[model samples]
Target: MKAFCEEYNIKGGIWNDSNFRAILEATMYLPVTDKDYRKWLNFFFENCSYNQLLFNRIQLNEGTENKMFSDRDLVVQRLEAKLLRYTDAKECETEYCLKLTSVFERLDLLFNNSWKKDVLDLITRLPHEQYNQDEINKKLSFIYSNEDCDDVLVQIKELLGLYDFETAKSENKSEIRELLKYPHYYKVLVITGTTGSGKTFFVNRYIKYCLEKLKIRDISIIPYVFDISKVVSDSNLEQLLIHEMADLLGKSVQSLEDASKLLSYLPIKICFVIENIHLIIDEKSKWNSLISCINRFSRYEEFKWLLTINGYEYYALEDISNFLQRYCIEKNSLLNISKKRLAIFQHAVNMDELNKEWHVVETILQKTLSGRMSNTYVDVNKGITTPLEALYFRECIEGEEWVSSPSTYYEFIKKIFDWKANKLAECNSTTVQSTVLVIVDCVIEKLNCVIKDSELNKSDLSCLRSVQLLSSTITICKENFSVSYGFQQISYRIRVFPYWAAIMVKNRFRSKEFKVESITGYPAELKEWLIPCYIFYNAQNENALLSLFPALKKASLLEYALFCAQRDSSVFSKALYNFIIKNVDYIKSSKRCYSVFYFVFYCPLRISQKFKLFTSIAGKVKEFNLLNLYSRVFKSVVHTSKKLKQLKKNMLELAPCDVLDINYINGYETGEVFMHLSNNEEKSFDIVINDIIAYIREHESILEIIKNGNNSSFFDFFIRKCMENYLKSKKKI
Candidate 1:
């Protein structure tokens, strides 16, 4: 076989009885750096297709058909000997060189069918809160017995329930078992719950239990569970179910009709679990046909169905299934734990002996502690229900040390932000540091959402629960700015903020901000930490802009700047405006000047300051010929009619050459008034006659330039370029 294989350029000789042990020993002794040996090893794998060739070569005794492997099992024995030799050699370099021991162990597991032990150990060690170990073991056993089924592989991995924590649902499981025992009594069992209420988890556990019960009863039951969310197309569901049934029952199903026939004729029982049924529940015709098909197969005691639906759509499904109401055996709504039970569960989680869930919490408190807890803040008598809520209340009570020294305070707040980010990253996932940074970005997004909602006076605290953020009324600004002229009214939701978020803002204001370029690259893992620091900052401070790092001057960084500076508010001032104006060239070259332009209008400035800020911006706009700047002014500039009139009066006082730069801006702003004059497109601009006359009279000097045709471009811009858009809207009517 060696000579034949060599001539044919094949590697069959490695598996031959005469060469198996010899090749194993040769590879074991060979150096990893040896080019010829590496080539030979690669060639062996290329020809062998893993352990298949070796398995086929092992001779077996006759009538030992069900035995998974041959009695000789020389391949595993030789591999084991080679592994022992490598480990016993006591040489670190050689250990690295011949690291094929893992491969050999895998081969051994396959031959001896001992992979189940490793799987069981993994299931046992998995976070108990996320998955039930016994249910997982049962699932693995069933999958192991039916390994030939294509869906079994995916089912095994999903049953392990990694990447998600599991909530206890023993009550739901017990109810499901009672219904599943009498399969003939109910054609379908529907598990209903809100999204994330453990409906799918409950159904998965129920299916495992039913499969185990069937095994005990000596009934041939094949379980096929599919999450409808994974189904991509309209027809994919029917085809996948058909294919899975065919594979499970060892029969052919060319179509739905074929599958129905196979189910009818098959004497064996089958359990089918379908999750996220709400996805297709709204399809009246499709849902009716699907139900009819299930009803057809329900004629036999061999078929049983378990379906899950989102509770929000439970009423919709009730309407759709009016005809099949009698066949529906159970409609169980999975619910969150009650407040009393929640307290018990949280206490259990905190005191968990296996995982030591509270060990990390204790570590965080130690690292971030700056002061002793205060009785006024820490209400010891307040019974904390959840572990997370307890942590929140603990932090609220244990206020940070108020350092009289600036440097110490800066360091203290920075440590707090770092600790919060790191702790949140740990709680979310066991991701490496590189990936943890990326996940922390969700903090910024959540913070932005909270700030946006706060601006609209619609900030609701419930949304912050997932991120462990709490919202309290914070008076960031002492003075109450009027909300007239499109300025956001100061919201009462500002004062009390997430403890972690307040630390981040404090750090930013103290000139200890994190590198946006460095931190922004990491995935946003936590939401509470990402809350915008600018939202709670002392916006009234004139030195706020100066305190910001140069790296944060970019558009993306400025996007986090809240537009809270109204006329009387001191969020932005002349000093900051002048500082930004000095960097006009840098600002113009950058793609994001909108934030700068946004600051100009979003900030409340005197009519004189508004013109001064515009003049500085308009100077660069003229130099760079920045047309978008003028367009944005029309689109975004917010002001009262009085302020608008004052600005018009100021512009009219300028020379024709000076006014030329702002002509398009004034034209667009004036034209927009006519656009919104009436809801009906056909309505004449007669309603805003007084306003238009006032605008024309205020800027008569600019209009004079247009009338004389001295600057024909300015006249054509307002009438043809700007006013033409409103004309087009009228034509559409």
Candidate 2:
């Protein structure tokens, strides 16, 4: 055992203790005489703690120290008698009976007739020992005898199942009882909001307040925070309440059901605060069922139900309005002034956080009151003038100023009454439509011009133009429209397909596949140009494309070449030729477009070798087609295709005016022209090579790159040659 521990690198003296016990148990359980077993037991007893030895002491009442053992001996005797009766029934096999008897004998020695002896005796006496009957009986007897046995068993079972009890308690458990003090007045208090509005946080805080501040003695009165989100089907509301209660209390489900069954008899007062009641509303006929349950419990003065949801209007409870009215009347709960009830038009508005600007709020209130007054023709000189009366009176007074310093609440009330009386005199006067159309029309016209001049791509400009057009058309139609109808119409249009399309074009480029020829005069070879042009059209408009046409054209050629090179060498060459051929007529018509063409041919020559090989050939073919078509327009034109063919024909035609050696060509005039063409072609190839290098560097593992036999060798050789050349140039031998 020592060697085994050393070989496994096991550390700590504690591990040795376990090993020693295991070895001792093995020796005792071996097929040996009782004397040998006793010897094995003695070895453990000699080294064991004094408490362990005392616990195992079998000689009951032999000394004062063995008093516990004496009591255990009596318990064991009772258990053994019970077991003997079961064994006499012949429910167990002889072998199992023998084994059980042996177990009891071992217990007699090990426990020294302690409290555990009875447990062992009960185990031995179980009827069908061969069929695990003894094990079941022992478990039953142990649970029945111990007061906290069920809880302990549950904890052990949870631990075996890997449930984290500490985490569950911290996350889910909450207690609420403080609200009971105002139970009659605040019975139907609701916490309503959208998801992530901190509804759960508020509920948890309320629960904590109840537990700590209220110091409620009756745990049963504590609120059971139920998550109705889990109630997918029409579950018994009573059963669900009990299940949630059990979860909160950390009690078994069966125990909870039993408690629930006896709830009517138990004098337990529970406040249920259900979250996500919308889920319950989804279950068939559950709304009325839940309402019935709440009403039944509400009859008990102590029972309270606090239901929360995102919106109240969504609830389809039968007689809900009447129920709410009755509850509010009975509970004396104050209903909050809803957004709609307050006649506030705006759902949300941005305001400077640091500054208090109540203009919008005041305006809304004033307008609502004035509209009501105009419609009713009521004399504002009422006995008790409300805030609504004051607003109406203010509107009627107009230029005439009425002033009064109301220091006290009563004085303030008197002034309001006086204002209402004045407004009543002028009540049946007139109603005016607020016309802010001229300013809106001017803004729309300015936006249209700005959008047009911004040179946005067609898509973006189209969207902006659509929005402007729609807004103008709607404004014209709504010249005498009601404010509410106008607002609704505008909102509806904004959400409609045409307006949505405009928004898509203005913001994101249209993702739908469409043919280039259908929209643009640009050829397919100029896809690179057309795409960005389209993006600009979607983002800005046509004005933007015209302004950046030269740069767009150059970019298109370069991009097209790079794409072709990457995909297929032959395809890239053909595409490059096609681009030049298609644009030959345009180039002939406009001399300014020649520079763009020159740049396209220049990029391939200056690019990296791998890209250069493909682009150079393509650029030559493209240049040949252009020069051949426009030979008459040039003074000293070089037909480079014939020279390039000749260079290819001659194995050692050094410095030939071919695509490969276009960069090396000399002369102030010819060199300038050649450089311009070579640069664009080289740039196109450079882009391709750079992209490949970036991809390889990012994704290919260094180890794999280095291990790649031929590629690695070639790269290494190139590096060495470059370094040698650099050294030679520096004269560093």
Question: Model 1, 111-141: lDDT tens per residue?
Answer: 2222232333334333554346467556755
How many clashes in each candidate?
28, 33
Candidate 2 vs. true structure, TM-score: 0.24
Tens-place lDDT per residue, model 2, 608-695, is 2212232223344344444432222121222232232232222111121233222212112222333334344554434533543453
For each candidate in turn, the TM-score is 0.29, 0.24
Worst 10 residues of 1 by lDDT: 346-355
Candidate 2 structure lDDT: 0.33
Give Cα-based local distance difference scores for all models. Answer: 0.41, 0.33
- Tell me the spans in candidate 1 whose CA falls farther than 4 Å from its real position: 2-59, 62-65, 69-538, 543-570, 573-595, 598-612, 628-662, 678-683, 686-691, 698-709, 712-716, 719-733
Candidate 2's error at 692, in angstroms? 50
Count clashing residue pairs in model 1. 28
- The local lDDT score (0 to 100) that residue 23 gets in candidate 1 is 39
Cα lDDT of candidate 1 equals: 0.41
